[model samples]
Target: MGNRILIVDDAAFMRMMIKDILTKNGYEVVAEAADGQQAVELFKEHAPDLVTMDITMPEMDGITALKEIKTIKSDAKVIMCSAMGQQAMVIDAIQAGAKDFIVKPFQADRVLEAISKAIG
Candidate 1:
């Protein structure tokens, strides 16, 4: 929870909720993005210790951005966020190098657990 984190989600509310969870838990939210394209750009600029990425997004998707970020920093620690039941997408994300994943309607404990596992 001490690591710097970048949050990527198309919904402003989702981003805000995540930021709230992370900040309250003593994590630094270095940057936030509304889409995968922006997420990739911000990743380069911030070089955050971790990234929380949303699967379905505009301009680009989390998987694509994850791949792009991996190209930039092969060891980038990215934790994907997805809605429930997107099994194929979750598998794809894992295969593409996501450190972990969290399902939406984000539970504070679950979020922290994923972050802990990813950053540790």
Candidate 2:
């Protein structure tokens, strides 16, 4: 099977967009979460190979969720997604253990590249 992945994004459109890119590239989307809290819960449930996490969310935010996921599985691979100009949050995500990050208005190649680098 292709590398399993979990996608987290508050915006349904964004989630769909990433899911589309991943599915088309032969990645298996194990599950999806609309908020960081859900992301954490799904992470525990699915244990996907990698996660594409949005930086901002309603309940927990991506950085906090990333830390929580790290505590659950220290070697968990996560990639933070951010809109342009969220550099501070992106840096925080990296420090919190994200494997890589992709900017918003998502580019297919960049998204695929980050996922490949993180899990393969």
Per-prediction TM-score to the true structure, in the order listed: 0.97, 0.98
Over the stretch 1-120, how does candidate 1's per-residue lDDT look in tens digits? 349999999999999999999999899999999999999999999899999999999999999999999999999999999999998999999999999999999999999999998888
Residues 12-91, model 2: lDDT tens digits: 99999999999998999999999999999999999999999999999999999999999999999999999999999999
Clashing pairs in 1: none
TM-score of 2: 0.98
The segments of candidate 2 whose C-alpha lies over 4 angstroms from its true place after superposition are none
